[model samples]
Target: MNKFNGNKFKMDYSQFKTEVSKRRRSAATRELTKIAYSTPHSVISLAEGMPNEETFPFTEISIKLNDGSDFVLEGNELAAALQYIPSQGFPPLLQVIREFQRKAHAPPLWDSREVLIVAGGQDGLSKALEAIIGPGDPILVQNPVYPGVNVVITPHNAELIPIEQDDYGVIPICLRKRLQEREASSLKMPKIMYINATGANPTGTVMPLERRKQIYRIACEYNFLILDDDPYHFMYFTDEAPRSFLSLDTEGRVIRLDSFSKVLSSGLRIGVITAASPLVASIELHMQSSHLHAPTLSQVILYKLLKIWGYDKMMEHFRRIRSFYKERRDLIVKVAEEHLLGIAEFSVPSAGFFLWIKVPGIEDTWKMVMQRGVTHGILVAPGAAFMADTSKPCNAIRASFAKASYKEMNVAIERLALLIKDELAKNRSILNGNT
Candidate 1:
C-alpha cells in the first residue's frame, strides 16, 4: 500500500513499523527451515541442524476428552509436535485458524491479509506494541485499559492518551473530540489506537456494531491503525456478536488479536493476529528472535481437537461455554443488586466475567478493595489497576464471576456492601471533623 505524499507516493502503513522492528531480521536457520519445509520431499538433503526424532523418548501422546472420547498423537504427527516448526505456525493449524477467521470475522481484505499464531493474546499484543511504538511515541488507549497492555506500554515510554468509554463501550464522539483537540495541541499524533472491542476488560461492555464502524471511520480519517484486542469475543452475552473492527476494516487499518483463552484452555497459550501481509510478516520476524514459535504440542493438540470437533461442533462448544458464563453473569448481577442496590451502582455486564461497580462515597477503590475488601476475605480487582494513570484514584472496582460459586458470590457481595457502608461512614466522619 502506498500513500500520496504531495507529488510523490510513499509506503503507507509501513510508517507504523518502529525502528526496532525495521532492524529485526529473521534467524538464518529459521529462514532455511521455511524453505526446507516447502521443497519437494526429494530436494531436502540436510541444511538446518534439526534434532533426530528417533532420540525423542515420547512414543505417543493420548488425550482423553470430558465425554470419554480420546485421540492419540503418534507417528508423523507426534514427530512434528515434538519438533520446532515455522515461526508463522504449524501449517495445518494455521490453515484451520485462517478458515475460522474467515468465517468469523470476514475481514474485507482477506486475500492480502495474513494470520500469525502467537504464544497467547498478551504475547501478540506485546509484540504488536513493540513492533510499532518507539520511545516517546503517542498512543491512544481506552480509559481504564487492560493492565497487561499498560505493562507493555510502560516499558516503551509511550504516552497513553485515554479515550473515554460508556456502557456501549468507547464513545465515538469522545474519541473524535479528543482527536480534534489533539490537532491544536503540541502532543504528537498517535499512530495506533488500542481497544478491547468485545466484552472489554474490567467493564464487560461490548462495543455496538455502529460504534465499531464509527471508530473504524475515525481511524481511516486520522490515519491510525486500530488494535482490536478482542480476547472475549466468544464470551458475549448477546444472542449475536457485533461486527468486529476487522470486518469493517476496508482499508486494512485494523490489526486484530484473537485468543483461545476465554472460550478454550488459557494454559495452552494460543492466540492469532490477523492483519495485512506486511504487518503480519514484521510480527513474525519478531517471533523468530523471541520464543521460536508458539508451543508446537499445544498447536497440535488444538488442531486435533478442532479437526475432531469440526467447525460446526466447535461453534456448538462455544455456545455451550457462553451459556455457562451467561448463567454466572446473571447470578452475580442478582446478588450484587440484592446487596449493594442503593449504596453502590453497577451496570449489568453484557459480556465477559467482570462487573464494574461504582461506589459514590469511595474516592479510590485501591484502599477499599486491596486493603479492606481483602481483610473481609473478598478478592476483587481494584479499578486503579486498569487506569492509564495508576497514581490517580479510581471510584470503581472490578468483581469477576468467572470462578466464584453462587454462594461465594453472594457472600462476597454481602461483605462488599458492608465494606462500602463502613467506608462511607468513615468518610462522612472525616468531613464532619474537618468542618
Candidate 2:
C-alpha cells in the first residue's frame, strides 16, 4: 500500500445539515410535512393552490421531430418534456405570451416592451424583488396577501408595509394615505406596491376596472413601482372581468407577472414578466445569473400548442376551466350557507381557487385546523400563514376547491362544519364559566 492509501475513514458531512438559515425554520415547513403524512379519505384538499392537472387537454398535444417517427410521448407532449434548450427561453414561446397579454389586456403598442420567461410566477416575483428591492427597502403589499411573496420578502431583509384592503383589492384610499404618512414621517417610501389585482388570494376579491385606474394613478403619484402578480386573471367566470393594471399603466411603473400554473400544467413551471424594456433587461440579467433561464422544452411545447390552438381556442379552454371551478365554488358556498353562514362568515369569490372563511371566537385558526381538524380527516390553510406577522392570532382559514372531487368536497365540508361547531361550543362554554 502507498503512504496515503488504504485506511477506511468516514467523512464528517454533519456540517451541511446545520447550515440552514433561521428563516428556513418556519412553521410552514413543518406544517407541509404534517400535511404530507396525514391521509384524509374524504380529503377535500382545499389547501393545494395549484390547478387540477386532470383538466389539461392531453389529446390536443403533438410534437413534430426531425426523425422519421412522430413521437406522441405517452400520448402527451413528450418532445417538449424531454428537450433542454435555452436560458432566456424559446423566442416562439415569448411571442405566444406577448400575444396572450395583448388580447387579454388590450395594452397600447410599445415597440420596446417585451416578455422575460422564468420558472413560474413565484420565480419571476423573487427575481423582480431582487432586481428592484435592496435590503431594508420598504415594499407595500395588501394586509392579507399571498404567502409566497412573504416567503421571499423575509429572507431578503425587505420591510413589508401591510396596507389594509377592502373587497376591492388593495383599497386605493389606504394606499394613498399610507404613502402620505410615509412621506410626512420621512420614512422610507415603498419601492414597490405588490397587488394581486385580478383575483386576490385568500380573500377571493377582484378589483374593479375603475379601481385599477385609481391604483395606477396612485402608483404614478407616489412614484412607486407596481408589481401586478396576476395568475388567476383568466379564471373569471363573470363576463365583466376587471381591466388589468398593466393596460392602465401609462407610466413605465408596472411590472406584470402571468403564469400558466393555474390554466395549464403547474409542473411545467412556466411564467412570464412583462414591463418596460429597461426593467425587463435588468430582470433578464438577474435570471441569467440565478436560474440561467427558464427551461426551453416547456417554452417550445407551449409555443406549439399556442400556434395550433390559437388565442380564441385557448380562451374557450379557460372558459371551460372557469365553468368547472365556478360550479365547485357554488357547491362550497351552498354548503357554507347551510352549515357555516350563521356560524362563520365568508366573501364569495368570483374567480380563482380560494374562499376566505372567518370563524368567530377562534384565535390561532392555523394551529386549531392542523392539530384538530387535520387529525379529524379534514385540511385547510389557516389565515395566519398569509400574514407577515405570525405571532398575531388569526380567526380565518383559506379553503380551495381546485383539487377535490365533488363527493370528497361534500364530506370535507360536513366535517369542517362539525369542527367549527365544536370549537364554537367550547368558546361559549368558557364564556359561561362551564369549562
Specify the highest-lDDT model's number: 1
Q: Single out the weakest 10-residue window by summed lDDT for candidate 1.
A: 1-10
- Candidate 2 residue spans exceeding 4 A from truth: 1-86, 433-435
Model 1, span 74-119: residue lDDT tens = 9998999999888989889989998999998787758778889999
Clashing pairs in 1: none
- Tell me the TM-score of model 1: 0.95
Backbone clash count for every predicted candidate, in the order shown: 0, 1
TM-score of 2: 0.81
What are the RMSDs of all candidates, in order? 3.4, 15.2
lDDT value for candidate 2? Answer: 0.74
What TM-score, over all chains together, does every model reach?
Answer: 0.95, 0.81
